[model samples]
Target: MEVKKAIIPVAGLGTRFLPATKSMPKEMLPIIDKPVIHFVVEEALASGIDDIIFVTGRSKRSIEDYFDGSPELEMHLKQHKKHDLLEKVQDIASLADIHYIRQKEPKGLGDAILRAEKHVGDEPFAVLLGDDIVVNEQPCTRQLIDIYQKYGRSTIAVKEVPKEKISSYGIIKGKPLDHSLYVLEDIVEKPDVDKAPSNIGAIGRYVFTPEIFNCIKETSSGVGNEIQLTDGIRNLNRSQKVYGYKFNGTRYDTGDKVEYVKAIINFALNNENMKDNILEYLQDVLASKNNA
Candidate 1:
């Protein structure tokens, strides 16, 4: 079956971002010109997902409004003859068939996804975490969808992180099926580096069969007193086969301050309007730092 629906969990309290996120959602923070969630939605749209279910919490109204039509702003832009900017704004509102649901509580990723059970029905669907932005010729979610189509089972995107950073991710031990493809044998959530099964860590992109909802329900709360999605996926794997694909992409964890800054600089460096100026500015900064 074609995966036409996606669930994005954006209910997290952006504690890391503190005062900046106190009044605004971290997902609404801009990378360069566009907000983080904008890129996520664009990825889903590019990956053939037309239906988007966002599991939101309090203070997330801005997210909904960002994607909704702004008549006043549209009129102003149109009157100013800013056709290019007006078209972009119009495109965002009509980007997809978007729906919102509240998590009600600060549950983990598993619970955030479970809120979409009714909307997703019994079909296979994709889950894209709003915090991670992946750049590639092929969308990351689409890569996992392609794997699910071939295997007829659940699939998750994986990438090799450095061993030192293993504990920060859900590490997976898989039996190699093909180059960059593996039949997942085990998955551990945030294990110590010395105890980690492998360096391959699961990223935020997932394509799951409906059976995962049941597994999540059966899963008990683990780390941080919240139901972990990694645990749910591990349980689901026990009942049925699950595959992991080492996706080809550059993934930015925008939730981290350093990574968020890196994403901004990297994106700006590639942007046509900002590339030359940013390049010269960065060169001067580097030169100044060296002289100091």
Candidate 2:
């Protein structure tokens, strides 16, 4: 079956971003001219997902408004004959058939995902983590969907992170099936470097079968007293085939401040209008620092 629906978990408190995130959602933070959530939703649309289910928190009003049509703004743009800008604003509102429901509490990734059960029904669906921004030739979720279709089972995106950073991510220990695919073995969530199963860290992109909800329900909370999705995947792997694919892409973890700035700079350098100016400005700043 073609994966036409996606569940996006955007209900996190985004505590790391503090004061700026005090009144607005971190997902709404501007990447340049556009917000972070804009890129994420665009990725889903590019991946052939027509239906989107957003698991939202109480404070995420800005998120809802972004996707909602702004009639006054649209009217002003149209009256001013800003045709190009008007099309872009209208496009955001009509991006997809979006539905949202409250998470009500801060549980975990697993719980946020479980909330999408009713909307997703019995078919297999993709789950795209909000803060993971993957710039690739193909959308990350689409890459996972291609693998899921071939294997007829669940597939998770993996990347080889440094051993020192192993504890910060869910590390997987699995046998190699192909150059980029790994057979299911075990996944350890935040294991210390010495005890980590392997260097292959599971990233945020995933295509899961409906059966995964049951596994998540059976999973017990770990680490931060919240139900971790990695634990759910470990439990799911017991009875079914779960594979990991080393996806082709540059993934930016926007949840971290340093990485977020890097993402902004990297994206700006590749942008047509901003590239030359941003690069020259950065070079001048570097030269001044060295001279000082």
Candidate 3:
């Protein structure tokens, strides 16, 4: 089966980013020249996803506008003979067939995904958390999708985190199918370090079957009286095979301040147009710090 649609839950309040996110969606925050969400959307598009369902919230109109056409800007650029820049602006609008719906309340990732039930219908779809940016030789979502196609089961992207950080993410306990794949036996949401099942922490990329919606619907509120997608995936394990693929990639959690800065620096240092200038600037800054 060809997986064609994806759901992006972008409605979080981004409390970690505070005043900067006060009037802006964290996904709208620029990594350098592009918003964080742009990278996510580009990943999805590159991975053969054709339709994007954005589960959004209030004050996120800018997100919609970013992908929508910019007539005035395009006209000004065209008039100024900045054809390259004008085409770039025009390209955003043609990237993918995008649709948006309100998440209504900031429930949880499960609830946010649930909002896409109608749009997703009976097909297998993906859920890409707005804050995770997976940089891989192959797209992270596609990696999971390939696993899904081979095994005919839902798949989640997993990567090892520090043992002490297990409590910060959903930890999976599983038997190894291979060095990089695990047949997930269970998932524990934010367990104490001593009690954690494994160091395999679940990240944001998931390729779920329609049956997942059933699991999500049946799942009751969990900790903090919220619907957790992790809980739903755990429940899905009861009747179906769920696998975790420790994907080949480096993932950046943009929701964290330090990681966000690191991601930008990493990208800038590798970017063709910005590498030399950014490297020289960084060298000077470090030189000054050492002198001080």
Candidate 2 TM-score versus the reference: 0.97
**Residue pairs with clashing backbones, model 1:** none
**What does candidate 3's lDDT look like per residue over 204-234, in tens digits?**
9999999999898898888568899989999
For every model shown, what is its TM-score relative to the native structure?
0.98, 0.97, 0.97
Each prediction's Cα RMSD?
A: 0.9, 1.0, 1.1
lDDT of each: 0.95, 0.92, 0.93
How many clashes in each candidate?
Answer: 0, 0, 0
What is the Å distance of residue 156 in model 3 from its true position? 0.2
Candidate 1, TM-score vs. the true structure? 0.98
Largest lDDT belongs to which candidate? 1
Candidate 2, residues 95-203, lDDT tens digits: the string is: 9999998999989999999998988989999998888899998998899999999989999999999777788899999899989999879998899999988899998
> What are the per-residue Cα lDDT tens digits for candidate 1 across 1-292?
9999999999999999999999999999998789999999999999999999999998888999999999999999999999999999999999999999999999899999999999999999999999899999999999999999998999999999987789889899999998899999999999998899999999999999999999999999988889999999999999999999999899999998999999999999989999999999999999999999
Error of 3 at 57 (Å): 0.4
Residue ranges of candidate 2 with Cα displaced over 4 Å? none
